[model samples]
Target: MTSEPAEAEPANQPADLFDLSHNVNFLLRLAHARGDLLFNEAMGDLDLTPRQAALLHAVDRCEGGNISVLTVVTGMDRGTLSEMTPRLVKRGLLDRRPAPGDGRAKSLYLTPAGDALLQLARQRTASLRERVLASMPEEYHDLFVKMLAQLVGLETETRIVHDLPTVTRRRT
Candidate 1:
């Protein structure tokens, strides 16, 4: 007797893989823009940008992550970090202090007000994330997150590159 398997119907497969709306790049950009819009809307009351919120939250989590560490964590360039840090400090949302005995090395922390703001930002961010994921099956959220984490880096001969490293010179 023949043992060939029956062919699956076209209903189980996409008719075309090259559709622009279904393209990964297009989809990613569309989703990012939508998320950005919602995040800006939610954060407008506090006049906080996404980067500012990220920096504040990162500082809150790390008692004294230095500028270099924060640059790495927040994925912000030195120029932008320098500009934003002082503004946040001026606004009393962040504290910038010298690291222990190193007058040149500064550590960042969230002030009382920053902490409260971070809490509110966190709540809003979580709500936005939930809303975004609502279109997908709940069972796929973990897998979706995992797949996203995988797509971020480009592999090199010996390493994977995501973002530029934050470089800090050391005293001799």
Candidate 2:
């Protein structure tokens, strides 16, 4: 008697093995893309990229901070901040001076123009935040931000701070 080979099915497999809609990475990417689109439409004439704005804001908050400090505060790399500083200085939006203790290290500061632009950007972005939050339920607003902060290891940080760095999504 010949016995038929028994078919074995994988145990506990999902109906759709690779469902992107339920993927964290894919969801984060889509959220980022949506944020960028909203920011671009909102910041009509700012011409400042999100990275550039973050750098400027960091300089303003940390006045006289060097590239290394900006990197820590902005979550940007040394190379990108180094490249951006010169361009901002050329545009008269930032000023670079020799660090007080370290002559070789240059400190950064936002010029009057940079500060003004940043203020405008902040206003526009406040509205953008409202729009983004509008999509989710009102009760989840704080929780949503908390969850994001936790994801980025900022859960321990105070929820409200006068100088907390803003995470913008717009770019030129």
Q: Largest TM-score belongs to which candidate?
A: 2
Stretches of candidate 2 above 4 Å error?
1-17, 154-172
TM-score of each: 0.71, 0.78
lDDT of each: 0.72, 0.75
Candidate 1 worst ten-residue window by lDDT: 154-163
Q: Over the stretch 60-156, how does candidate 1's per-residue lDDT look in tens digits? A: 6555767776665555677888889999999999998888768899888788998899889888887777777889999998788767755763222
Model 1 lDDT at residue 78: 77
Q: Tell me the spans in candidate 1 whose CA falls farther than 4 Å from its real position.
A: 1-18, 153-172
Give the per-residue lDDT digits (tens) of candidate 2, residues 1-172: 9999898767535634446766677889998888788888877588888788878877776778788766766667899999988999999899998888789988787789998988898888788888878989989988998798768754332232233333222222
- Provide the lDDT at 8 for model 2: 75
